[model samples]
Target chain A: MANDPISQFQIKNIVPIEIGGLDLSFTNSSLFMVATAAAAAGFLFLTTANRGLVPSRLQSISEMSYEFVASMLRDGAGSQGMRFFPMVFSLFMFILVANLFGMFPYFFTVTSHIIVTFALAMLVIGTVVVYGFWKHGLHFLNLFVPSGVPGLLMPLVVMIEVISFLSRPISLSVRLFANMLAGHITLKVFAGFVVSLGGMGALGIGGAILPLFMTVALTALEFLVAFLQAYVFAVLTCMYLNDALHPGH
Target chain B: MFVVTPAYAESNPTEGTHSEAGAPGGDAHGGGAFPPFDQSTFASQLLWLAITFGLFYLLMSRVIVPRIGGILEHRRDRIAQDLDEANRLKEEADNAIAAYEQELAEARKKASAIAETAREKAKAAADAERSTSEAELAAKMADAEKSISAIKAKALGDVDAIAEDTASDLVKHLLGGSLTKAEVAAAIRAASGK
Candidate 1:
């Protein structure tokens, strides 16, 4: 179908999916989310199943992934923050795998949706808040109150801090969603050019070849961006956690 | 541009059917259709978060951390063992040096004692030789004195004998031949200095 590319993002109602008249559509987005989770679990399981002194290929990859995340957490958050390594590592792998999976022809880009990205961002921010409170109690609020500030500027500083705090989720979610959506849109636009021009005469077809090359180039660049975005998300999460742990510093 | 028109036509059919069947609200199939916020999605997200957190925590705590810790502990043990061995070697070297010093002192003492003993023996031997030489010289002087006295006695005796013989010969001559031996001796005594 000509519309299949756009329709890939559509929500299809499945058996009403209701416990008590709640219209919960098991949409294409939901299906992709489940697929992403299953794939993540299977990949980790397969890679880590055979633990050996000398590593196989899969084991090497798993070990490398482990070291990568550990180093990142240690570098960004220090030894005291090492306890958060697992959460940050999982978040990175999950998002990276999901983004890569979405690049396939039949797959849906779950990160392109605002709700999914927002949910992930909220979780990271919420963890920072909750962990801060749990660890430091009411003293965590000292993060807003800058030390050595003049009494007159205290209130202004606190207001700025609160505004910055509230904007965290928006920035986090928007960064991921915007990147995913823009990359997909650009890819689609380029692909459309190639397909349309290729159907014309030889001169038009010749013109289409350039777009095809550009699409390939852009796709490769998108892959790199996908990996970088995951890394950025995980590193930022660690930094936020660090802030929560050591507030005023 | 030609591809865009065809894509719009294909998407429009689905939009028409969706609007006709659904409630009279905002367009569900519009270009900017955003799903309404549902609180239930939070529960799903939370569930996923919990599952992932638990699984990852278990992997890190039970599997990864322990392995790394074991490696570190083993390295520490090896280093400690090497240090202990080095210390032992150092102690052994110290002991050997101490032993060598002790033996050297003992040899010096023994050497000095032997030299002193040898010096005493040499002095005694020299003293004994000197005493023996002095005794031999005294005996030789005594023997020479005895020989000189004997020679002096013997010469005196010989001188007395010769004087007697000469006096007898002079008396015989003074007696005028062989008259009477008694008368001749008397005459010689009278003439000699009476």
Candidate 2:
């Protein structure tokens, strides 16, 4: 019972609330989300509060993250995409901080859930669609029609393009969701192995060493995935935003 | 950290039992769906995610992004200004060096000119002094020659008179005869002439 891996992902209510028959109770998920936002915002605000010409250690970190996202956007979306800098930066920092927060034991991984990731993905895709239409009107549909497709296969190619385009949100959301979920489950399972095996005698303790090592290794890998997923998410967001900015190609 | 997970699990034994027992026919959260896929908590999770993410975006757009961006922009401007100042100072220094070199060259030229004029003046003065001394020496030599000629002439005149008196005395002593002064004079004159 104490070794149930799935229990960690349970959304236990912290402050149960009933409003209009909707279950908007603040759960552990919400707590971690709030924590992630606070950590990200608070760190940036505090570190750059002084706004030194030469940044301090903490300040350097803040500046590095800023430059990192800025350059990522500039590269992925070009100069025109700079208008979306705030959104892209916000997404990047939120995911990065949330994923790091999830790395802690007993902490809820906000990104581990599909609905949350889907919402975030939809936010990006929605921005792209709205902004694309608003900025370029129906011309944004040119994205589905490749410029060099032959006349006969044009419809077939566009159909493929449309299907692929629709899959962007799903892939974006699922990639992060699946990675976080799978990594955490794997880590938990191996950790469970260590516990179950160690419960036996000295022979079992010796046998548990392998899973213990694996668990340790997996934890390190999970940390990498945490940071990597955040980066991939931000990069993909930039690319999608790029599509919105220049939908023709 | 590992210890914390088990302790956490122990504290939430209900959730653990619920998942294990109700894997087939899970209840609200655990009966049918995985915890992440559980539709029951979707609204709440979405609400909080929206709330926190929206606030985060606002903070970033309103305060944080601008602040960091301003810092970067300010640093870039400062560096550019510093580089400009450095270039200006270097140009000024180069100009100063050029001016100093030109002044040094001019001073050297002026000094040589002064030295050349001084040398010419010294040489001219020496030549003038030499010519004046030579003129004085020539005048002195001419005067000495004039005086020597006069002395010679006077001695010659006295010698003539003495020679005549001596000749008369010799004739008187030799012949015991007195000759007249005019005759003696004539005789001496004739002798001189002969």
Candidate 3:
């Protein structure tokens, strides 16, 4: 278990609670989730406290994140989609911070959990559905029936559209979860290889360098994946929100 | 295998407690579920995620968005005002240059006009002086001509008196007596006329 890669993801109870037979134990996963939220919010708050006209380095990063998410939302859903800015910004920051936090040794990756990712995905799709219906009423169903579909093939097209639409939450959640799960697992395996091989002999020590280098390279790639997955999550959220805004096409 | 079911929520907490009783290292490969799929932690994680995420969303919407947006907007307005000021300054400088050039041209025209008037005045004075000198020279020439005519008339009278004296003296010497003044004058006049 010293080199157990899967063990890194274990959720140990920090404070076990059983109220009314409910397992609401405060675990390492919960701790990191709170930490992720704090870090995401703290970075933005502390850096931009000055609100400098000429931004400092850290302040530039804060402003850049704001503009980055703003432009992403505007591009995906247009200016009218800005109503969802808070939600989209929170999701992006939370996932980004959580993913980066997992890169540390012995840290839990909150986003790697399927339920967490699914919840987030559902949150986005839920917004789309609720707002779509609220704004357009019955016309929101028109999203399933695209414009210019011939009456003959309309049913088949609509069935495909409905299936695709239903699969949005699944695909969105699984993509982030799978990517983080696979990347972390692969990184842990290679790092474990370095440790195990170095333990064997002098010759094995030399062999361990390859995996050591691989671990380093994979760490870099994981960083990229972390940011990329966050961006992907935000962008997809915007596009889905677009459906709520204009559901016809 | 990735599907989430509510049954695991009830089942895994017992397993979790059982695992906690076992060796810590046995948690990963022990007879428990994978950590991500371990439904024992789902309720806690979901609850915490909801709390923190909700707080985050509220903070973003209520505080951070307005602050950053205001900063950016204020910066944009400042830049626009600075640009407008620069344009105004440029226009003012252009007007100043135009005014200077116009004054310079006007001054040059006035200088030439003054020179032209002076030149015309000098020419008129020279013409007047020349005419006065010519008139004074003509008066002097007329006075000199009148004096010369008087002198010529007086000399002619003297010549007549001398000729009469010489003729009377010659008659007294040759014919023993001078003829009368009238006869002598008449004979001399007859000879000069012949």
Which has the greatest DockQ? 2
Number of colliding residue pairs in each model: 0, 3, 0
Where is model 2 more than 4 Å wrong at Cα? B1-32, B148-194
All candidates' chain B TM-scores are 0.47, 0.65, 0.53
**Residue A44 in model 1: lDDT:** 62
Better of 1 and 2 by DockQ: 2
Off by over 4 Å in 3: B1-30, B125-194
List DockQ, one per candidate, in order: 0.08, 0.40, 0.30
Between 1 and 3, whose lDDT is larger?
A: 3
TM-score for each candidate, following the candidate numbering: 0.65, 0.86, 0.81
TM-score, cand. 1 vs. native: 0.65
How does residue B135 of candidate 3 score in lDDT? 86
Residues A102-221 of candidate 3: C-alpha lDDT, one tens digit per residue: 999888999999989999999999999999999999999999999898999999999999999999999999999999999998998888888878988999999999999999999999
Tell me the interface RMSD of every candidate, in Å. Answer: 5.3, 5.1, 7.3
Clash count for candidate 2 is: 3
Least lDDT summed over 10 consecutive residues: which range in candidate 3 chain B? B1-10
lDDT by residue for model 2 (B1-194), tens: 45446645564556545344323233566433457877767778889999999999999999999999999999999999999999999999999999999999999999999999999999999999999999999999999999999999999898879988998899899999988888888988898889
The Cα error of candidate 3 at residue B153, in Å, is: 11
